[model samples]
Target: MRYESIVRNTEFSRAYRRGKSYVSPFLVTYVLRRKRGGVRLGITTSKKIGGAVQRVRARRVIREAYYAMGLNEEQSVDLVFVARTATTRVKMQKVEKAMRAHLTAAGLLSR
Candidate 1:
């Protein structure tokens, strides 16, 4: 299924300021519970990671991995995945694993 995306600057800022965060070699995740709406996701890749191509690849990998998780829920939450340098080189499964770990830590996923 497709995900509702976190598109506004305010939405992203709110998650960063109030969310619980988890870090892995491949990704950094920030999660916040929302009062209403479905799950909204954001993937961030910066110039520190690489040039345009690498940045795009990182976002794509994170998106695909997130999609594979099937974390659909009626409960509203915002998840932000920040791509690290390693994210560009790693396979999608690794990214997915990292994401699962973070979400689990945040209690978005079951143990």
Candidate 2:
């Protein structure tokens, strides 16, 4: 199932305040359980990652990695993926792997 985007500032803040986080070299992931059905995804790339081009690239890579995971639509969760500076240079596979690892650890992945 296609996941929805978490687009509001409040949504991001909610995830930050209530979520469990996992960090890797390329990404920091926050996962929060939601009462709503289906998953919502949010991605952020800070200035520390680089200039606009680099930051946008980081967001693109993170979004791609998340789409590759094929998460179940039946699950209810809010996921925020924050890009690290290292993310600008990492391959998509590495990003995807890091995401999968975190989701698995969080018990969001069914296996």
Candidate 3:
């Protein structure tokens, strides 16, 4: 199933206020259980990461990593992936690994 994007500022705020977070060298993930079915994903990169190009790259990397994980459709959660400055310099494999680790820790991965 395709994951929906969490586009509203309030949605991000809610997740930040009520979610559990996991931090790695490259990424910080916030997971909030939602009453709605299916998963929603949000990605954010701060200016500290770099200019527009670097920030966009960081968001793309995070998005690709989440897509690579192949999460099941039954998960009912909202996820926010926050990119750190390190993300712009890290390899894709490391980013994917970090995403998996965080998802597993949050019990979102079926296996």
Candidate 2, residues 1-111, lDDT tens digits: the string is 577899999999999999999999899999999887889999998899999999999999998888888887888999999999999998999999999999999998866
Residues 1-111 of candidate 3 have per-residue lDDT tens digits of 478999999999999999999999999999999887999999988899999999999999988888888998887999999999999998888999999999999999855
CA lDDT, candidate 2, residue 7: 96
Displacement of residue 31 (Cα, Å) in model 2 is 0.3
- Count of clashes, each model: 0, 0, 0
The global Cα lDDT (0 to 1) of model 3 is: 0.92
Task: Pick the TM-score winner.
Answer: 3
Q: RMSD of model 2, in Å?
A: 1.0
Local accuracy by lDDT, each model: 0.91, 0.92, 0.92
How big is the RMSD of model 1?
0.9
TM-score of predicted structure 1: 0.95
TM-score on alpha carbons, each prediction: 0.95, 0.95, 0.96
Candidate 1 structure quality by residue, lDDT tens digits, 18-99: 9999999999999999888788889888899999999999999999998898896776898999999999999999999999
Off by over 4 Å in 1: none
Off by over 4 Å in 2: none
